[model samples]
Target: MLAKVLEEPERGEFFARREDEAHSLVNLLQAILDYASLSPSLKRRFTSALIRLSSKSGRFPDCMVLEEVTRLGEDPVAAGSFGEVWKGSFYSEVIAMKVLKVYERSNVKELLKRFSAEIIIWRQLSHPNLIPFYGVYYLNASKTRICLISPWMQNGNVVQYLRREPDIERSYLMLDIARGLEYLHSGKPGIVHGDLKGENILITSSRRACLTDFGLASARDSELIMSSSTPNARVTGTLRWQAPELLNYEAENTRSTFASDVYSFGCVGYEIYSGEIPFHEVKSDYYVMQSVTRGARPPRPPLSLCQTRGLDDTLWAILQSCWLKDAAARPTAEYLVSRLRAMPRNAEEKTTPAAHGWDRLTRSRLSHSLVDHPLSCSAKVVQEWKQLSLFEDWEA
Candidate 1:
């Protein structure tokens, strides 16, 4: 199963929708033929069939590949909303790249504003724990891309780690995140990580984790700017991790502060210990608003959750403080990082054996990039990346 998944992850088990359920995915005929690199005749036969299918569908598998491949210097390992994230190979050295999806954008004028702002925002800060952007590149006349050739974040995300390795050093991981956030929020301009959740954070190849995706980040005074636009572009962020204010749909009509971020961060903290969706008991955003506004509080963190995860009363209290309903009661990122540093020493986790999807090749093939990979990462990310062999070099 491991070998098969690595060789043909698209057809392997554990996909959200069954193969028959998704007919539009570019067929794997060509990739299969390429993997059979030893057989020229097989490749030729597959090529003929591929050509015929492309003629009918008006798309080719290889045609979907990234163009520049320069700054990244290699092909994409994972792809997402703005573009493909390629593995960078800079003058023999390898790093990662985030390339823009040209075809995905319709309004170039609007895209330029958002894209430029995102680039400038990332450039303003630097930390060993933050996902760093090497720089931006423009190829030809209309193409633009952001290359982040930093230390590759290898463990995937914290959310998935919670479920699979619920015993991982939570205090250690949280401290790493807090320290990075402290740097971001206490800077000269004081950047507030507008979107703080599990999915956006990536664990490094070095076993160290860092916060990422500051596209929505801003300073204390401008935190409210997140919902500054009407109806907003693409809902601003993931709904499950949204604060009560955001879950209420008054985003554009009201204001947000570091307090709002605190509320959201609380949910993120729960994800660390429970390894479950912050409010999995609820159904949807409307359900969330009904429950949280009516005082539906998450369960209290247990001593076991803290002990097993290498956290303590102080750090747990701090995590919960980030999630208080009233923004005023929530701790600032700077404070959270400070308190997190006081975590108690705990043993490392004993991870369960890999799941079906986390076995090999399937582990590296993240199903859809639009699932959101910023502002910490989703709860299931590390598990999925494990299945895809994304952390091929990392031990369990």
Candidate 2:
């Protein structure tokens, strides 16, 4: 099958074949590349073969390369499963260049199909809460290094921005994220942001959060290169933020759902307010998975921290609702938007020092709580299963 794909020309009948297999094709390549048992020497051989074949798979014409794309940097500023994102310029204006990793090497037919499809879909997307897609251009004469362009966000991702400016109003940011999700979920065929971690949520210059790295299985079909030791680190980070259904092996399907995204939004909320990832207290990814599968959720922030960060009871409850064990029990993104719109002001009035003290007094009397206790510590980062290829065949 691989050889058959390789024999096709850039404009041949093969590149025009079935489009839906794009994500699956990418997954097949990922399975080979991420196979842990492959020795480094053997892996390098496979990479070389892919690289050699990449040049032949090029499809876009020279005219397609945007003249406005001024400069592309040598080193990538960020990396992920899709590819490397380099800091660049579009007609002298700063921009982000999303250089995809799969197109150059992975299967040519499905990738071009996926890229063409996503380009149209991404182009049609117009929302204040989404990072707008500019255009695509070839970075080199070989046409192997194609880039998807967008505005350069100086504020960085939501997590990085919050950590740098700890005093920023978190509720406002959360609302931005919620509105973005609402826009996506409100679409004709609601776009499920399969990945919704803080890293994928960029903070615009206006200080609003905008969603990126979505579509094409949340862009899992391409390699967005990362600086991590292995690509699996991205999946590991995802595991910490995943919905219970996505983590459950007993479940027939583990594909990300709208409900799973809501659960991840809850994790992102924890990151925004507490400056920590969900299950930060747990070191082992496997253990976090184990705990979540066993009905355990991330423990709440300390009372003092919660009060300081405006994570008042109302806001905490909203976040808790997003993490409901039953997917159907979780609130929709639209519901969250409405609730968050009035949350900050109401929470402020309700969480005054006096109110905090009063809550502290009464909270102890209530035996029940909104969230579960943190799982007891048992292990650190276990090297036994360094790479989890759980999402390779994840449903679209």
Highest TM-score, which number? 2
Q: How far out, in Å, is residue 46 in model 1? A: 57
Report the C-alpha lDDT of model 1 over 1-396, residue by residue, as the tens digit.
Answer: 222332332333322322222112223443444343535434333333333233223332321222333444445677766667666543333445665565444554345445443444464455766776544444445543334333345566777555666556666666667767777766644555767788878776555567787656643323212232212422576666666666665544543446666666677777777677767867776776677767676775567765675555665667666667776767887777656544435222113211111112311332221122221222233344465563344332
Candidate RMSDs in Å, in order, are 20.1, 19.2
lDDT of each: 0.51, 0.61
| Model 2, position 150: C-alpha lDDT score | 74
Worst 10 residues of 1 by lDDT: 350-359
Task: Give the number of the best model, judged by lDDT.
Answer: 2
Q: Which stretches of candidate 1 lie over 4 Å from their true place?
A: 1-76, 102-106, 139-141, 144-151, 160-166, 220-234, 251-256, 301-307, 311-313, 346-396
TM-score of candidate 2 versus the correct structure, residues matched by position: 0.66
Query: Alpha carbon lDDT of residue 337, candidate 1?
Result: 65
